[model samples]
Target chain A: MNTTLQQFNVEKIRTDFPILQQEVHGKPLVYLDNAATSQTPTVVIEALQKYYREYNSNVHRGVHRLSHIATDAYEGAREKVRRFLNASSLQEIIFTKGTTDGINLLASSIGRGLIKPGDEIVISAMEHHSNIVPWQLMCEDRGARLRVIPINDDGEIIFEAYEDLLNERTKLVSIVHTSNSLGTVNPLRQIIDLAHNKNVPVLVDGAQAVPHTAVDLRALDCDFFVFSSHKVFGPTGVGVLYGKKEWLEKLPPYQGGGDMILNVTFAGTKFNELPYKFEAGTPNIADVIGLGVALDYVQQIGYDAISSWENELIQYALKRLQEIEGLRFIGNAKHRAGAISFVLENIHPHDIGTILDREGVAVRTGHHCTQPVMQCFKVPATTRASFAFYNTKEEIDLLIKALYKVIEMFS
Target chain B: MDELRDLYQEVILDHNKNPKNYFQMDEATHSAEGHNPLCGDQVEVFLKVDNERIIDISFQGHGCAISKAASSVMTTMLKGKTITEAKKLFEKYQHLITAEMSEAVDLHEYGHLAVFAGVREFPMRVKCASLSWHTMLQALEEKKEIATTE
Candidate 1:
């Protein structure tokens, strides 16, 4: 690692996000809903504008000059993603609509082809509905059993139980690297290792993890990883799915359409190679290119600095939030990333969210697409304040103050 | 805090804390469960009708003040009224909040429900306020209303 030249500046970084400058309900917007979707940087917005403004042509097939430029930019984005996750090859990365689409693509394709009766698909209790439903549908289709590894009170996955769940019958072990609800960062290395021992493939839901921390596919050694671009400062409707070459090649295509086929006749058709086979349609070229720019922006900032800044923000928020009376903080996992779930006694989560929003503080207040997780916690819903690198302690203080107001109103 | 207090008036809070007709009715003709997946507000509405008249009504649940108050008031107002009258009252009450059938509602008799009129300002809470009423309608097997899990 090279010694840092210029230290990361939080104030300078905040200026890059145009939406953050605006006021909502008479107060400055303190966006804490980054886990849902991050606000795009000016560079990313400009990239999208530049694409439509300059090279607005269909990619891959056209022999025209603009087509070549468009194709290059689109494929260039793929290379950026290839480096972003530290995947061994560009062929491993496939673009989908978002994280849900990516997981569904894997589950529908591989789960349809390989999984059989009596086989088991192991998933953790912390999985989003996107991760859980696809496996459930696949298992239902294949006569395979769906097994869940439960989480502890601390919201971390019980690694011992996860190991116990892994056996010869386990076909796939899909788990979220970082939980969206609890901010629990699961032990993926041990999870991958245990699954690999049983000749099972592991698909990591990296939607929450990719935005907050460094994700090295080579180091984690997971067979598959998926994350959405929107959650990481890029446009919505674009996500990256990285799979080992062998696994992707063996699995069938997800959706059959224009771009994925090499040659088609009345009688038969031949599919295109690796990622193109999976992509299968006119992709979100502009957004993917913009995602490349977002990745570039993050690379410029550097993850180590981002992590340190966010860790400080989280610690500060947690300490201050602890002081409010009747404010019960949920998900007290030792290892966390940019999420805080809690409840103000006698106040509905929706009310808390409403008041917070009125104070120009945006937070998620619901089951967060994880109804089962809410069941485990024995709460109907919780107000979740998720942070990002651009977020400041000032914003966290604003949240604390607003939450205090909510407590007073409800109690 | 005052805005929230305005939303959760003394009447709403009084009902929320010690709700009127808050119990399971014995020998009830119909009972239905209202579950809001979003906030986890689960309400069970029990109705006892005699010759199309709601002789007694009650509700039991765990929820926010708005939901609790809505159910409590709904049960309180429905008693001693015919099923048709109760249906009309629900319509007038809903119209008062949603501004859908505002013209039909007198807005005087339904004054307690007026506190909930602000509920329409918050779209998400609209479902929370209506969950119990929709559940009650479902228990009565009224075909016009639809029960939803918010």
Candidate 2:
């Protein structure tokens, strides 16, 4: 490892993860399942344990000191998220259950109000089900067309084809910033610009992107960005949706409940302002604070360094898996993140995954919840081994060694 | 070899590589397809039955070693058996793999399938191993309902 990347310290970083020090089937665990959800750091877990131990109270309505402290921590997380994504204001950041709930909130609120009959909502074929299902449901409800941007053989969105799909009827263009299955980092800056020229808003699903790369919402100029905290090495049940203040104010409230309301007389009630208006009922308070710690953890290590290190891991993994005969990688995108997907001839992905698991190397097998991308690649599924910054080249070598055993067994 | 001995025995791998009764019967009376989307296991079971007796049975699909081997072993045992007898075999095989009736299963008849009897220990793979059996049941139902309808 380079001295710059070693500032994060792989051994020290692994120490923070208690699960990493353990064994699976009498062998040391080699976890490569970051694309699903990353292993949480000690600071994130301690933050959650500390919150429940003390200052455990519902936020936003208390006058006591504990309640006040809890409220500050909860809202402080929103501010951290706002800064992390480089959003214009704190009001633009709304807490959600996860990326799925965030996209659904946008689809129901903004999508219902803006998308009309004969309008078009564009999405890429490489999107997760969370990104695809919401827009699909919205389009089916409204008499709108769900246009898909075709992906190239490498699984990146075809930019020219996406630009051609944008027209006067295009109301929204939602896409994944990085494909979960393929690890293709899409050209969001250009995609957002083209949609803006057509006067259409765009939503970038940053669930996979946020973990490996840094995002600046202002520079990207997209209307909305959504990501889950768990994928970013934080606790689950906490996520953030960053939207422009102007766009958020124009849209309807997401869910109607106690916190979202100002006055309820059963006839007509006034709604709360921007961020709170979107957040209904009680939110995942402890996890939200843990998300702040997770962001602070990444900031301390530096995302720029983390990105380069993960890219190196991806490259090393690709090269190692390539050396195994009859083992072909599925997604070979040039501008990819930290996912390595492949298939072995005469060996099913599940079998490969199982055999690898016995050797203490874990990898995800099958469609990876992106069925359309699987269809685009014309393979039923691929075994994916995704990496985090803490991952080492030695781990990739172990993966290759185990994969060779799998290939030989089938041969 | 000892490391892979417990999971992929020689008999199991042999059956997987050169699967017995593995072909497509074009003039099959019963055919059904089954898929496990979670693992991307797909199996199409084709059976040729004549007067309530299975004259031939084969499978054509892609899957894990356990699934491929399990289906091949089931086909070898079920060929030339009556539909009712095959249904009984299906039940016995299900019980054998699920560890419901382990001691009762005869190893001589089951052959390589005896290796799959250990599969019940691995719960997650039980679905992959049971996929072809599910397709067989589906084919049996299709034969019953469609045959009556015709």
Off by over 4 Å in 2: A1-8, B1-4, B100-112, B143-150
**Top lDDT prediction, candidate number:** 1
Interface RMSD of each: 2.4, 1.9
For candidate 2, the per-residue lDDT at A361 reads 91
User: Best candidate, DockQ-wise?
Assistant: 2
Docking class of 2: medium
Writing each residue's lDDT as its tens digit, candidate 2 over A117-152 gives: 999989998899898999889999988999999988
TM-score of 1: 0.95
For each candidate, the alpha-carbon lDDT, in order, equals 0.87, 0.85
Candidate 1 interface RMSD value: 2.4
For candidate 2, what is the DockQ? 0.56
Model 2, B12-119: lDDT tens per residue?
A: 788888888889989998998888867667888899999999999999888788888888888988889898988887786777667743356566776545777766
Q: Lowest lDDT 10-mer window, candidate 2 chain B?
A: B141-150
lDDT of 2 at A2: 67
TM-score of each: 0.95, 0.94
